[model samples]
Target: MLENWHDVNGLIGNSLIYFDRNDQQWHQSWIDTNGSSLALAGGFIGGVLTLSGTKPNTGELHEIQWRPLKLGRVEQIWRMSLDNGATWTPRFRGIYYAVDQQN
Candidate 1:
């Protein structure tokens, strides 16, 4: 579930992958408590992703990175850092699978 700084419920839709002309970085757009924004950026290599943004209400900073896999299924090893990428804490590992059928 998604929530705002005030703890109000929010929503997120399908991810949009695009290249930001301003920053010259690849990013995925999503809607969160902070409205629609770039939630993830294509990192250095090996499917590494990074996220750094400020909270809407409290102005708190957030930083996270992960390496994702998506050949047959979706999986990621996500990590979070509070001190400007100085250190990271393994929070959770997630995976999802889906199939398509035609009648």
Candidate 2:
């Protein structure tokens, strides 16, 4: 999570995303412990796209070039697997803190 070096701790993160230039297509996701804070990426993230082919008449190869952002919140998680992804366990868990007196 984009962190704050100050606060009694902190509540949630206020995250946003923007690319180098104002062109092309993209997609993103946002999340929070209470489903409040949001994160984003382009639609092309983890998606396939047609690429210029190395051979003639082959057109283009589809490419998938989307990277998911790992915004760490108190509620974010990471899965640990000993069997190389055969199975996984939650390695990380976020601590839930209310942002208000009544949440």
Q: Go through the candidates in order and give each one's C-alpha lDDT.
A: 0.54, 0.34
* Candidate 2 wrong stretches, greater than 4 Å: 4-75, 95-98, 101-103
What is the per-residue lDDT of model 1 for residues 1-103, given as tens digits with 9 covering 90 to 100? 2322222254534545567789977665445554544365654455666655543444334454545456666555656556656776775565655666772
lDDT of 2 by residue, 4-102 (tens): 222244544343334435656342233344444323333442333211111123322222132233353233333444443455555334444446677
Model 2 global lDDT (CA atoms, 0 to 1): 0.34
